[model samples]
Target: MYNKGTIIPGLVIFIVFVTFPLWYNGLNAGTVPKPDLPIGQKECVAPAAEMRDNHMKLLNEWRDAVLREDDRVMVKVGGKEYRKGLQMACMQCHNDKEKFCDSCHTYAAVQPTCWDCHLTPKEAASKKETH
Candidate 1:
């Protein structure tokens, strides 16, 4: 290893660059976001843990079912029928999107596409009121 003087330092620099993020973040997964729960509503379409992990997947399935199969698709949970949609079903209870949705999503560093098509309940109401 005739080039050990330059090669060893180069290898060290490369390793540090590769592992910098892991060290900077202390291998610490960020704190779990504490989203505000819906008031006067004790249950969601799915259980809390399932929803936390797979809400996007569930929403995508709901979107497919509603758009491809039927617009009036209803989901029955805990003896209640909900018209499958972000606005119609989910937002009925989780009206404050900033508090309920944004908190968790921001922590997870995701930008959901749902808002591209639908307004938050508060926004919809404000627009309706102005009109």
Candidate 2:
């Protein structure tokens, strides 16, 4: 009877500690679809274009803010202040490369070799060896 209770507790422990994080990470790595716009709605109907334009404008503003040296919004890493770019911000909504990066890269016919040399901004390589 004690062994049976122990089995259930051990299984629960394994599920909570081991399986849960792996499942969470896997779920986080994939592309999350936008709730408002369902899949297969590629062609601009009318209002979508305006909304897209507005979104682009906001993105550009964010980019400009980061580019500005005077702007205090920055992340400090290894004693250097690095401005956050669009890629970092945008990835919050569109996490997968196929959903976000590939779409724009394909549209512009530009192949970005970023993944070859660079990890995501959050996981940037250590600068300790540079100096």
Candidate 3:
């Protein structure tokens, strides 16, 4: 081939570019974040593993049920009734958003929009005090 030298170097460059991310990241997945679980709170609306994977879907469903269908959206688990929403339920137990929510969210590189509308427990209390 007349372009042997150029073709070989071009192929090398292409392969390096294609695999750049793996090389840069060292093929290491990253450390899993362990959020601080609530003390003395054993049960949840769903199991731990289920919630880790599908909390967003559950929250969206709850929102739809409460707003669209006019349902009260109360979920009972382990004899405790929980109102379906971030503020009323999830934040009640996971009160420290930075410790409980932010840890895992940051590790997963996600920006959850839940805080956009609902004030965190600490924020709500502080706002009430200010007013």
Candidate 4:
């Protein structure tokens, strides 16, 4: 027969080990990403949820349009035509890509390759200031 004293302590240890992450996260969870609206703009090219869910898909489409299709970079969403370039267009509003883009990407565990080919807002500003 199992001893009640040993069994109870073992069960408690097992439960705590299994649920440690839940308690830890609940106590010290990171906040969700919140991008600020660009100056003079009320809304983004697409809806908030749409952008959150499918921005990568949209970027791939844009890349194909520009790199493959030769500058057919117009994306019409929500009755407005947006030129699908990160530096030329999206950066105008989301100036701090590190805070806005990287924060969310980090939270979601996605490693976006944009920074490999693009300058961050801070980098772009410094480059401009030096000239």
C-alpha positional error of residue 22 in candidate 2 after TM-score superposition, expressed in Å: 49
Q: Worst ten-residue run, lDDT, model 4?
A: 72-81
Q: Candidate 1 residues 1-131, lDDT tens each?
A: 79999999999999999999988999898778888888878888878999988999999988888889887677775567888888988988888999999997898789999989999888899999999
lDDT tens readout by residue for model 4, 1-131: 57999999999999999999987898777787775556665677778889879988987877777879888566554456667788776776778777778777778898988888889889988999999
What TM-score, over all chains together, does every model reach? 0.79, 0.32, 0.79, 0.71
Q: Pick the candidate with the highest lDDT.
A: 1
Better of 2 and 4 by TM-score: 4
* Residue 89 Cα positional deviation in candidate 3, in Å, after optimal superposition: 0.9
> What is candidate 3's lDDT per residue for 54-80, written digit by digit as tens?
999998887788779978677776677
State, as a TM-score between 0 and 1, how close model 1 is to the true structure.
0.79
Any residue pairs clashing in model 1, and if so which?
none
C-alpha lDDT of all candidate models, in order: 0.87, 0.53, 0.85, 0.78
lDDT of 2 by residue, 19-87 (tens): 786767875655444433334334322255674557556545665676665453664433444445545
lDDT of 1 at 73: 72
Clashing pairs in 4: none
Residue range with the least summed lDDT across 10 consecutive positions in model 1: 71-80
How many clashes show up per model?
0, 0, 0, 0
Better of 1 and 2 by lDDT: 1
